[model samples]
Target: MMALQHRYPLALAIAASLLSGPVLAQSAIEHHVWQDKRKFEPYSRTAESITGAIRLSGNNQFATPGSKMTITFGNGKKAQLTSVGASWRQWDDVDGKKVTAEVFKVAKDPGTLLNGNTLCGKAAKYLVFHESLSFGASLLGVAVFEGSKEPKDINSPGLCGTFNYSVD
Candidate 1:
């Protein structure tokens, strides 16, 4: 009986490893679709036109390469995607009007934020503009779940907050 128990765990482990392949493959395909600009459906020109870092509500510094963000798709689906560093001009006075502005290139196409296959859902259809102006240094958006019936809106607290930004 003892020997059987030990072998059962090993068998289960092997089976799990084998089963993970297709899941991983699907993740890869989803990520590829996210990266392909041609696959994106138009959401908002005003939101897409804005250029700035996507600092999560509590984050102090802007999202640089390797920063992580969590995205929730309805139906109990969630994903965490990493930011990849992209070049943009440093913060400068907007129109030299005393207001400063900087560009986070990834915000131009939120899919560029996917670094690996952590985004596992029914595939994101639109990167919807969610909110802005929290912590004075952040912008929030959502990857609308494909086929979802829920309205696109700022539904997650993780995406927006009024507390002071924290550096971690």
Candidate 2:
């Protein structure tokens, strides 16, 4: 189970296969869910939102400058969040030298926006840091996808989950 925690970020990568399997494309993949998490009542929702990414090709690092993040609620329901930014670094296997790879992600909730397109609209800003690592499971390496964050800007979005080498 300890390895699962490290794989939290990659949750989104398998989300497609877990939901229906390898038959649809990215555009067709609008919603990613957990096989067991969705079994609960509090997780099922017709009006839900999610955002994340996985390594696809080569080693790279990504991020959004500043310690600020936001979620678009509706036309006027928006929220901002800050998490002191998250960072991770470690060594893997490199021909026997214990080579190391690193990744730094920073996300925050920027409050809520009121009058939006619908009664429930939300969005958040994220940065992906895939230094010397592939992200997309079927494509990249490191995969990190957590719940983002909520109004607290610290408690993590609604789901409070993340992914990395484990899930990847």
Candidate 3:
């Protein structure tokens, strides 16, 4: 009986360790990969422009986990797509005016649906705007970040406007 009791404890301990090994290994290997895919719809110039002579040209591929959208404006201002949670900032010269801006994402009502894929949900559409700056008295500086004044249309493609995407 004494020998049996000692062997039973050792067997229980071995079984416990064996059963926990796969669980631990499975959790260690578990990871999430964001497979969201996007496409850039060619933007058309309208009667009302967001920024004068500022054109947007970039490849749309916001997938691969760390992919980014590089938007180049005609005024030499470049806005790189970044996560709002990380607090990113960019500096550029617009029309020869020095400006600093921050990029962030905001949730849209009903979001944007492309090919049965909805974008701009919790971490969707991005907004790049000029950050408010105040210097000494009489030395105040202000930069205007404007989007389309038209009603919200997810399908509309314009500079400094909504970003439409399709998920995989």
Best by lDDT: 3
Model 3 misplaced regions, further than 4 Å: 1-43, 46-48, 52-62, 83-168
User: lDDT score, residue 78, model 3?
Assistant: 48
Q: What residue runs in model 2 are displaced by over 4 Å at the alpha carbon?
A: 1-66, 89-168
The whole-model lDDT of each prediction reads 0.30, 0.28, 0.32
- Show pairs that collide, candidate 3: 120-124
Task: Please give the lDDT score at residue 165 for candidate 3.
Answer: 15
Which tens-of-lDDT digit does each residue in 59-80 have in candidate 2? 1122222434332322323333
Which 10 consecutive positions of candidate 1 have the poorest summed lDDT?
Answer: 159-168
* Candidate ordering by lDDT (highest first): 3, 1, 2
lDDT-wise, the better of 1 and 3 is: 3
Q: Give the alpha carbon lDDT tens digit for every residue of 72-95 in model 1.
A: 321223335444332222211111
Candidate 2: residue 111 lDDT (0-100): 35
How far off is residue 15 in model 3, in Å? 54
